[model samples]
Target: MKQLNKILLFTVLLGTIYACSTKKDTVISRNYHALTSHFNILFNGEEAFKKGIEGINQGYKDDWFQQLPIEPIVFDDRKIVAPTFKNNSLGAGFGSKKEKTTTTQPAGPFEKAEEKAVKAIQKHGMNINGLERNRKIDDAYLLLGKARYYSQRFVPAVEAFNYVIANYPNANLIAETKIWRAKANIRMDNEEFAIETMKLLLVVTDTLEADLPNDIKEQANTALAMAYVKSDSLQKAKKHLILATRTQENKAQAARNMFVLGQMYANENKKDSAAAVFNKLANFKKAPYKYKIHANIELAKNVVNDSISSSVLSRLEKLIKDRDNRPYLDQLYYQVASLHEKNDSIALAVDYYNRSLRAKNGGDKQKSFTYENLGNLYFKNSEYQFASSYYDSVLNVSTDSLALRIRRVKRKYKNLASLINFENVVATNDSIIRIASLPKNEQESYFKNYIENLKKQDEEAAQLRLNQIAFGANSSSLQTNSKGEWYFYNSQVVSFGKTEFQKIWGKRKLEDNWRWSANASINTRNTDSVNVSKINTRYDLASYLETIPTDKQKIDTLKIDRNQALYELGLIYKEQFKNENLAIRRLERVLSLNPKAELVLPINWHLYQIYNKNGNLEKSNTHKNVILSEYPNTVFAQIIKNPENKIENKEVVNEVEKTYKKLYYLYKKGEFKNVLVNVNDVLPTINNSKLKPKFELLKAYAIGKYLDKETYQRALEFVAINYGSTEEGKKAKEILKQLTKE
Candidate 1:
């Protein structure tokens, strides 16, 4: 009886509201979609789109791009210190480090779109449902689908689009809904399905209104083209790309389109057409990629090399020298350098190489390569010292590239050994002079000052050593989260606690060095030492009796510290930065300080290695032979046996470096896309070498030159390991670290 009464009441209400509802439906359908779809201002994803694009642009670099783009900011987690690039700015970008409550925060475009769609749906959800219910409510569903699509909720977006399609068969927006649905399918890797549906969109062809928007058609075609490209359907890709080009209207956008098409054609060896499109793009000053200036430079090169026409040179100069284009000066300088090299103007080339180096900033990987080329040039000119110097620069920045480094070192070793021999002879002859020149008081004073300096250095060294150990161990735990930066987070609290702990207790570590002693240790510390060797008449002068017995102990401690310092110096000089002379000095100092048994042979081999440079060939071979006879089975001797044998192991890396060099060369030639692949290949093995930081830092710098922040951050992290201790490394670690966080 209740069900019957409800049905009777519902029929009465439906009849009562039918006339009013009919009038409303007609009004709703006529205006909103036909004029202002959704009847409200669209959030449009326009701001985000522009911001993302601008952010990328601000970050977008090719070879010479020099601008600070948006940096990644870590929210909390004080222990995680970020890296910086240059000393130009520090702590300017990241958020505070108060134990980072927001690691994976809710952000990104699609999320906003999805949220807005949901809010809109909630505001007007469902209306009438029967035959009389207006079908135009499907637009909200389309909005939902688009919102989800923007938010990257592809499946849900697809569902919303599907809802509009299935529920509103003859609705005005059926075409728009289908296009959105197809795009979602493309993202899901349902390319074939998307292509099929896009073709279905053709079935609605009548008026332009009856069909999808030209922009929608263009997007659909592009989606299909990319699908073809991804599937390796070159012909289809070209066909679709051409289709897109014809319809693309925005001049800058169209230029971007043409540039990409040209790049694809160039990739496929269709040079003439590629040249044509490049020419077309170069001619268009209105294009937004003016900073790139790539097409202009390349086309000019093609023209200049073919015939050194004044017009081509003028065009090239405009691209190179324009103030707006100065950010890409690395490429410009390199191009000019190449032209000088091509003209057999070696000195001019060297000058240009230096200019290129200066112009490179940190963002150009090709600049490290400038060292190699310049080194080669000097070597060819038989300016061995100059070559060695250039090689040293190359090695310092080119870690992991053993073949090139070894070769340069071999050359430099010859020169260094000759100098060492000269030093040895000079030292032997000058011994008498040194002794005769110094009076007793002066000698004593000299020794005393030397000892004091050594002591100070030792203390500083010990502290640094402790710092390294702390960094490698439980330092993370002691760290507290502060605000904004992860590194600063809770650091004050940690600092306070560390201070309090040190105050209450004495310094107690099993390890030997402990200069960062507690207050108690300081209070109970021994007074000034007395030298028993210099004592006078005994009148309770026992205060001066402490030194004679402890001399051996001090020597042992100094010896140990010196050796450790040598090992660090060796790694730093050899693997970290390739400052061979500094490496050699540190290693030799270890021997002079009489390091233990384990260190002697390695030091000797390294000395031999260092001596093998250009001017010291005889000495290098002498050391090599000495190592061969003495430490035949050691790693150093193994390298000495046949430098040629390592060539194959060097090949993958050789190819990797070669890729960068080639890209740099192409970059010099204004071939940006080729440089892209080179960056990709070399990017994978940036950390593979002892020179990884140098290479990786360069790579990140290169990527930062032409690409986006996200990619630049990625490359910088791999480099951070190599640079953590260095000033550049420190900067790189902080900068790249932040980027990684972002």
Candidate 2:
């Protein structure tokens, strides 16, 4: 029994020692756990950094990578912002170079491993008990900061880099830390801070200790170049980039720097320097600045065709076929088109122009400019009708449609008219030639039916092409009735072109029901605009052809049509469009064209109003004096010479109505601009008169549309403010304001 008790004591003592030994072993293992033990945990980040650099250098095409916006991953919060990376953090087979123990990491990205390292630090940043505490923690934090910085998150990036600086003063990566700190500063748009940090790096460059790696020095200088590029200081960029290109170990990176240097020189118009660099890059057979090959073609365009020979064109043609060259076909085709056009090769130019149009999809703004150029080329060659149609095609996409279309269409119409007449002249000349050459009877037979057939064919084709394009531009929307079938409304998208352009000066008849029922007078504002342009074109063409034709009858016929158009324009401006100045100008041109009696006092009264509105006090007073003095009983002069003496307000309405009755008679007699002025002088006094609003709007329309700039402003403002409730009043306000703003 005593022996059994001793044995129990021995067993209890052995149990206690065994327990202590097990606890110590557990503590040691926990303290010395190798990185290889957590291989999956630490392999992510290192693999990521390596793969990212490779993919970047591989020249990212539209991969899952390039489409993404670059988002940096931050550690403290373990959050990733947009441009989030895609696929795995690193693909399989990373970190194979490192040793593989249990804690030996599986090869993966630096980023993935860094992630593990980060998690470890987050839990133990201040816990200095283990081997991975303090310096290792500091290194992990610095590594984490760099990873975030490379991911393009400047704000969070700045935080990570700043952490390393604050916590790792004696760390081995301190020099790298300083350069990275500068890099972060550059990304933050703090170039001054970056420059200061970089300069300090330079001072440490030739340290007595002979310390940091040359690659780090190279990186620091590269950062300096980037900072300069951001600041738009190309000279500074050139100096530093030159250092990197020469001193850097990486040939591809050096090539990239050279390409940038060339681009900078190209932008500054230093062509020779640019050309040399580009040619060198072009010869670098495996260079990856894919866009650089495109610039060489542009540079070729500036080589000036002093001889305009086959060699230059041949040289250009060769450049387009380079296998690495198809991406910039738009530019290639444009230059070729320009070259062909310069060489007087119209068909070639047109073909290339079309190619250029087709070469790009929606990628370029140059497309519209190219189309307009082709249209103008055809226009200037006097293919007016074709040019006009081409310009219309341009208008479908053009931002400046109104002004451009009018200019094109008016030119087309005038040219078409002239072309028709020129053909007649040609026919007449051909007839004279035939009569001179043939027997008289044969001449008549030869000329008569041939001219007739040709005329009919030309007329049909011209009418068909013009009408189709004009009408095709206007498409309709359908409205369905309760009966169910839809009926199309006549969509009135007017192809007014020259007609509307003419209204800029005024020339249409007062079409019936043209005005909204809100006012007394008929409105032919749009119609009037159309007519005026036609009249002006008619006048111009007829007068232009006078000297070309020797026959008295031809000149006389031309002169008659010319006079008619001028008178029409004058009347259109004075009455239909209501531009007293335009009316006066048209009337004066009519007088110069020597029109028959109808356009005289209309001209004088228009002159009177235009002068008054223009603030030409002398001309206004003089015209009033002339009318009151010479044409004494002329009602217009009397009204102008005596505003206060005239009856006004409600009484003025009756009085002016009577006066305007006589003025309307004058208008009917075609003194429209004069009647407009007379009507205006009395409109203010009888604002409530039914006659007053009509005449006020009419006068405002005339003055605002063509004569006085500010008269439109004043009239619209007054009508809108005083008669805000009336529809005519609102329209007058809109049109008046629009006219004045113009």
Candidate 3:
């Protein structure tokens, strides 16, 4: 009887297991699939989707200087495709080195969620009489769409979203799915489609009184703003961004929207409105630290009155002193520097700029701005050397987006380089000439002093080496045992062994006959030999005297070059830099040097203009009369006598243009030599005219066409240096750069 009862229980268990099969549509089957899909598969999928979102948010770094995207999804401008799967079986002990390796073997969380969603739909989805009976199937589809969207598979994501909107119209997640589709469209550069779909969604939500969730409304509004932004309609974008900011679903996104709205207002020159918007963001307690800090800085920037400026400075100082704001010191110091500059406190501004450079966690962009500001200040002060150094720092830290500004800075730096080089040459030559004029005994004394300083430096270096060796020896003795077996581990012992071995055997290589001094000498033939007992000529008094230039022709040539450089620097300061004081100083120095007759007229003309601009009428008239009376036939005097000569000069420029056209025609007709001859003849006549660069560039082109590479390069370099400010000069520089690469 017990065996029969056990058999009945076993039979009942089998029947219950059979009734749980998903093939049937009874209550047990329906509940089993529904429960399994919702609780088991869909639950894990939803968790994975949430974790995927968290991962994306953690990885994304927003550039707050630009408008922020509404979502955290990182869309690559490059095309993305689904990864192809390959199952290659390697031989027993062999694998291809070309095989790719990744840290994470499986897909990311979103991809995992997508897989699970597909699995649930394939395994547990209930389709009865052309309807999905399992309600969780719609959720699985929504999860799939979201996963695909986050994974940047926009086309697939759109397809998934479209499937839901077409087949599951009455589902609770339909509105969200439509919003997702619109966002995906935007990602795919379908802004118009996205805008239309979002508008329809808004109409439907209002017409049906559906009462969509706040997050959905925020998303729709942000999407519309993004669409308008893509279309370059900032006014429309501002309206929607404001609407999105009010929804308060995503606080970070709300802060971003508000920030963009303020930037738009500022762009439209609505300073007060922009300041008001930024103030709202700055005062918001829960905004991200970045947004809050930048908003505050923006507000400070808008402070126009002295009273408001004082308050802003105090606030910025307080921020700088706060320990908790240490990470933001770079930006705070930059703002303080800007404020000081606005107040014309140049020294304080420079100090703050240096402080910003020293701050920790300051981005390259911020450092670039600081360097640029310092460069501008020094440039304004006519400190071209210091300005060039600062500009170099800017270039090191600046991005390609500032290409135009960087090119301008680089051009200015080139001019500065010329000035600095010529200034250094003049100063060095003057010092040398002065020293050369001293008596032989005094010159010997100077050489002796220089040699003494060199000897002292060498002695100090030798002492440092001895101290280092002694320290190493002492430390090694303490660490090593008395046994010679541990000698190899001691650095001092190793060094001593090497030195002693070298002294005895002379330098040798690790090869046969290394002990033979003759063989060693032959082996070390390529190595440099240091002979301590040998006297260097650089330290000898006679060699020093020999280096002082004594030839009268060489001295005169140097004076000529120096005067020419001074004259060029004067013109550069006058025309390029617009520093009249510096130009006046340089021109006066040129006159003191007794410049050539050709430079005197131009120098006088520049000084006259400088004095005129500075309101020194007496000095201006004095120089003007000198040019008019002494060099009346020159272009300088012609321009001063009648300003109408400028229009006549344009006619002269037209004649030069005709000459250039004739030479260009010769170049095209394969008469390259004639082109060169004509260009050379016309260039000197137009040397004082703006057409000089044009003529020189034509000559360079003709050279490139008719001459060897060296001649061509020389011609191009001449054009680049002499006419650096012209378009033709820029083209020459670019061509030279391309040739150098080849």
Q: Which one wins by TM-score: 1 or 3?
A: 3
Stretch of 10 with least lDDT, candidate 2: 63-72
Candidate 1, 540-582: lDDT as tens digits: 1232232222345654554465465555455455544456766
Each model's lDDT comes to 0.56, 0.56, 0.77
Candidate 2 vs 3: which has more lDDT: 3
Model 2 residue 75 lDDT? 26
The list of candidate 1 runs beyond 4 A from truth reads: 1-109, 125-143, 168-183, 199-213, 300-304, 308-310, 343-346, 360-362, 372-742
**Candidate 2 lDDT score at position 683:** 58
Clashing pairs in 3: none
Error of 2 at 212 (Å): 6.6
Stretches off by above 4 angstroms in model 3 are 1-30, 80-105, 300-302, 399-402, 438-546, 612-615, 632-742
lDDT of 2 by residue, 482-593 (tens): 1232212223323333344234324344566322122233335775464222333322333333324556676556555655455444544444334566556655665665
Please give me the total number of clashing residue pairs in predicted model 3.
0
Q: Residues 1-742, candidate 3: write the lDDT tens digits.
A: 9999999999988867865564567786677778888899989989999998888778888775555665655678576664332443211111233464333433788988887787677677666666677777788888888888887887777777887787788888888888889888888888999999998887777578677788888888998998888888888899999889886788888888888888888777787888889889988888887888888888776775788789879988987888988888888999999999999999999999999999999988889889989999998887888998998888888786457777887777777887788777777767777777788889889888986687567546655665565456656654453334455656655576567555444566788844333344443334586523323454456778778777888777778877877876776777677788888998999887888775676678778988988899999999999989996765567668766421223347677778778888888899989888887566545546777787788888988996899778767866665565568877987898799899
